[model samples]
Target: MPVYDQERAGGHPGRPLIQNQTVRIVVIYAIFGLAWIYGSDHIIDLLIDDKGMLLQIAVAKGFVFILCTATLLYILINRLLGQLAAADRGRLENLENLSQKNAQLRLFFESAPASLAMFDRDMRYMEVSRRWLSMYGLGERDIIGLSHYEVFPEIPEYWKECHRRGLAGETLREEAEEFRRADGSLQYVRWEIRPWYQAAGEVGGIVIFTEDITERKRFETALEANERFLRLLTDHLPGLVGYWNGDLTCGFANRPYRDWFGKNNDEIIGSTMRALLGEELFLQNEPHVRAVLAGEPQHFQRTLVKRDGETAYVWSHYIPDLVEGSVHGFYVLVSDVTELKRAETERQRLEHQLQQAQKMESVGRLAGGIAHDFNNLLTVIMGLAQLGMRELGAGHPTLVRLEGIQHAAEKSAALTSQLLGFARKQTIAPRALNLNGAVEEMLKMLKRLVGEDIDLAWNPGRDLWKVCMDPSQLDQILANLCVNARDAITDIGKITIETGNVSFDAEYCNAHFDFVPGEYVLLAVSDDGCGMDRETMAQIFEPFFSTKEIGRGTGLGLATVYGIVKQNNGFINTYSELGEGTTFKIYLPRHTEEGARPLPEAAPAPCHGGSETILLVEDEASILNVAVSLLTLQGYQVLPAAKPGDALELAQQHRDRIDLVITDVVMPDMNGRELVRRLLPFCPKVKCLYMSGYTANVIAHHGVLDQGVNFISKPFTMNDLAAKVRAVLDAKGEAVD
Candidate 1:
């Protein structure tokens, strides 16, 4: 303010034109006033000297006129001088105001926090404020009159173009630009430039304002790098990933998504979901997308077709991408789960099959147990009937009725035995025998069973290894096959039986479930008859399941065969097709032992009795009565009781009298063995005869009879019962006490 005031009070000191104008105005005003005053004094003296009477009057008028004129001139001159002095003061005040405003603007520009500069139309710096100078590490003297390129030599070409545009009257605003400092370090700057205009609206220079945003720039660069890294991480993920905009258009997608969708990135990006997946899929997914848009994450499953024309099951999770507490889009992740779904379905099917198998097995075990018990009762009835028929003469009418009753009971007993075999509870007596020899011996019986209408052929292997199996079961298997073959053939057909050795390998075992790798004796029976379909073969082993008409056949034959083979640790395979005939192959485990000689066939003999005191204990009253009568008729003194306690009392009363104890294995109060233990102390010399319908191992603990003890299975005839009792009582009995 002080310097500006001094300059303004004296007018601008360096401008001579302003000073000269003031001096010329002051001189002209003073000269005009002084000349007017002197001229009026001269004119008044002339007018006063010429004093003739008329002339004096005229002179007086003239003098008066001159004096008035002089007075008017002097007044006008004073006014002019005063006006000049006021004008000078006004000029000086105007200068002082302009200087003050200019000084304030200079102070503002120099002290501004941001960098500020004024560049001429040529892009040369006309003025640079202190902040601008400091930003560039330069003094005012170094920057002024310098071109922008000189101040920042490392400025990009684009920045130079921006400066040029600004100089050409266009405003330039750029977010960032790189400039080089004097120390060769790069500086990132954000700046704006506009053309500075004078009062006449002509472009003067550019006013440029800039901010150093180096740290902000670095932060932005780091953020971009991190985004790239995250994208890379998701690209290699196991599932597809994508981002959708608010309009459900794909904004971004990872590599997996592009590959899975079979679309180029360019084709998918910015495309609406409906365009990519079709309207059906898009509409179906609308609810899930809406949930995500509403700021809820959702999981869903879908079946989609891949690019390769294969269908795939996909599990997807959609999460909202939120900004400022509002959902912007969705983040979608999808995984293919087709195989998992298939596995789950397969597992459920297998579980159902297992449950069915378990139920069947349980029922079979129960049926087998009941059949074994029923057999015992039948044995006693049949033995008593046969004994009654024998005691009566052949001409007696009662003998014919008794024979019929025995025949019916024998048929019923045979049916129960088949049931026991199917349930795998029937006892088997296995002996090592050549399968070829066994088949050869059965050919004659098999031909007779199949009938003369059907042709039977045998293909026996000479060097076949021996197999251990129950002979009766083997015969039953052969008989069943022969019957089945006969039924299949409507007209004449050949049934071929082939026996050989078979060795299964690892590959063969893998293909079949529950099959072991081992040597086996193979018995194959082939029939050129009306074979079976897959459905029939699947359930061929099930009891009572048959394709034949009612009463035409009992379905237990094949079932019995299956049970026997399974119990003997063997496998049976059936190969047949409708109208193509059938083949049944049986695989029996190979035996290393030598084959045994065949047993001699025995002739039927009559029941024989002994003079032994037999204590017979049975729970059923009729069975007890009949058993006592039968044994007494066979010449033994039979002591009978319906209760275990009575039997014990009888044993105590006749401890020395009873020579043998024949008791039922399953009793109400005490079992046969328990009764035997109690009776043994009282009758120390007694030989025991145990009877039961249950299989040998199940009732006698693996057919083990105590000292001086023997066993008789139930459903026996009169001869079997009589013979067993006699054999036990006649032996040298061991001391039971």
Candidate 2:
């Protein structure tokens, strides 16, 4: 029999010993019974055969021995029952203790907050806590004994290697790992795996603890996306972009910003702004940046050097990038403004030049008006002088002196005409004329004007359209331009005059300022002479502004051409460069009915004086007296009035005697035409002769005389006035009023 230790069974040691004594008693009883049985059987047989009292006595003794042995066996049975009860009680106590310990361990593993799992050496799930099962969308029944592949089939190969490493006694603690769930969803987990150790310190299994880190992973992903977007935006931006930390250090810079600083990202990052841009430019911009970081928005201009060692001007804006309503850092945005500033300066210069030109033009008009009136007076004086000289003998010294005086007055008159042309007030009689024919007529004169060394060329286009312009003005324009070209040439050069009909379409018109789309007769003059610069070209149309030295050329030449061309509803363009030639193009509108010709010129005939009396009205008493004297000399009875009112009174007094009414066009009270209307009813047969020292409004307004009315420009000679008076009186005498 194997002896059991009572302490090991959780029972007292004395009870086990008492149980052993009872077992010893039961063993002695069994041994005695077997021996008595053997002896009784043999002795009983011998006593019966020999009839001996001793044999009967031995049999009875063996029975008594058997009875005693039965008694002892009963006692041994009782003791054996007690020892069996004690052993059963100790075994039951041990089972109860084990059940209590198991309940405590179950409570601990089931309620743990951390996801807990147990894996076998093969990386198969042996046990998993409730948290681990819930996390993986699994029940214990479905996951237990399942391989990692069965639970998560989509795990990456690297994850499998990690699992293997953990099972091989290597601990793995990865901060982030992606796990695919049974529902086909992904989870980010931060986990630690440690090998489970046996009592002997050998690896048995693996224990894993994991945490869900999906929100943190999402945050990181969003941060990366924003960074990538910012980088792409800055890469394609048009100007420099950068970021500065609170310490005025460069924290981030785009490609353009880095290039502007003559550095790369690595060289600029974490560097002070002063170090990147050098002390000069950095110090200049430092205050602005500091202001921005101090929560004030700042905008200013700065010049920065580029990687190619060139400087560029920029309009820069420094704005604070704020956090929690406080200045954190600064963001810089820059744009190039050099061209805009240059354009503004150029505009101001042009405005100043325009103002000067306007002032000179105004002065020229004033001087021209004065000269026009004075020239008319000189014409009268000169004509009188000529007449006096003719009356005197040619041998007389007084006649020669008078001739010299008349010549000087005539030259003064020509000067005044040029002045009037420059002022755009000169009388123009425009008619339709062929441009080709005009150029042909100018060729001879142009050749002489350009000098002997310079060649004159004409490229006249066939079938060129005719333009309506004054022929004399065209001649002057060509002469002035030729003279300018001659002066520009230092050596032998060529001047070309070209004429053609050009149709300006919309495209061409748009390119040329103030040009209209239409059929135009183009007159182009080009010269192979030293050309003028932009400054000279701008002032070339200004009166008194000339490149020629004193007395060589009048600055009024080009100004007169400009005024004439503009008055003709034409456009002029010039192209020239230094050391190159110059070209001037004059575009005049084409006239549709250019083939029509003017009526034949009437020959001047002798005016036959009549006995008819003439009533002459004049504003100036001297002109009225002079005219009366001249008409009396012509043998016409003259009645003169100093004013239109007096003239009307004279007409009424001699209604039948007054055959004609001669009056000044401009008067302080009534004009000549108005005076004529008033006198017409009183003396219906009277014809009118309108005269003025200035061109009458009726005649000069349209550059022509009114039909059936005679006009005499003032400062006329005595004979001119007499002839006009005689013609009016004679014509009225023939009329049957």
TM-score of each: 0.35, 0.45
Residue-by-residue lDDT tens digits, candidate 1, 1-737: 11235453555433454455557656755675566556755675665664464466656766776786577667755665666677677757867787887777778787776688887777788667788877777764576788878767778887788877876889878798887776888889988988887556778778899888898899999999999899889888888999999899999889989988778889999999989888988899988988899999999888998878888999999989989999999999999888898889879966975786788688788887888888888889899998998899679989888989899998887778687888888866799888887888888889999889877877787689888988878888999988988899887877878777666655346545677767778887777678788878998887777888899888888989999999999998886666656778888998765564643333334657877788899886765776686688789888888888998899878889998888887665767778878887788777777875432332322233443347764434455677788777667738342
lDDT of 1 at 55: 62
Candidate 1 weakest lDDT stretch, 10 residues: 695-704
- The local lDDT score (0 to 100) that residue 338 gets in candidate 2 is 64
RMSD in angstroms, candidate 2? 30.6
> Scored by Cα lDDT, where does model 2 land?
0.75
**What TM-score does candidate 1 reach?**
0.35
Cα-based RMSD of the predictions, in order?
31.7, 30.6
